[model samples]
Target: MAKKDDRGREGEERAARYLEERGYRVWDRNWRCPQGEIDIVADDGRDLVMVEVKTRRTDRFGHPFSAVDRRKRERLWRLAHAWMRAHPGAARGRSVRIDLIGITGERPATAVLEHLEDLR
Candidate 1:
């Protein structure tokens, strides 16, 4: 895979581990459809979380989370709805939330991870 793709996958994995460590059960990774893609789909106790994972080797331009602009957020929202429509049971009881996971650094061991929940 391309270097950037590799970095992104690594970041997603790290984000998943971080959430799992905090008790989130990850249900899917890299879920894609015609609308868009969700980096991670997880259950955080009482909510179904749709996560966007952004990874950067350095923040020269901006923090990784900065990449998740309003347009991207809109696309994510649509994707979340698409996911719910496809998997109705996943949203039966729990609330749906959008989350952002930003990772900055070259390696997982030293990467800085920041998770922002309920983005919308």
Candidate 2:
């Protein structure tokens, strides 16, 4: 894989571990459908969280979370519903939440990370 791709994966791994450490039960990683891929799918309490992880070596352009614009967030919601539908009862009556996890720095383990919940 390209260095950037590898770094991105590393960031995702870090994010997944971070979420798990915070008491979130991770259901899936890199979940995909026709719409697109969800970096992580984890549950907190009764809500299903669809995570979008953005990683960069630095915040030269902007914060990693800044990459997820409003349009991208909307797309994430669509993908989240698609995943829920495919899983049948997994999301029955439960709320679906969109989350963004941004990791900055080459070493994701020690990188600065931020988590934003409930985009919409």
lDDT of 1 by residue, 1-120 (tens): 799989998999999999999999999998989887899999999999999999999999999888988999999999999999989988997789999999999885469999999996
Q: Judged by lDDT against the true structure, how good is candidate 2?
A: 0.90
Which regions of candidate 1 fall more than 4 Å away from where they truly are?
none
Which 10-residue span in candidate 2 carries the lowest summed lDDT?
65-74
Error (Å) of candidate 2 at residue 5 is: 0.5
lDDT of 2 at 118: 87
Question: Candidate 2 residues 31-109, lDDT tens each?
Answer: 9888899999999977999999999999999988788888998899889889988998889889888988989886988
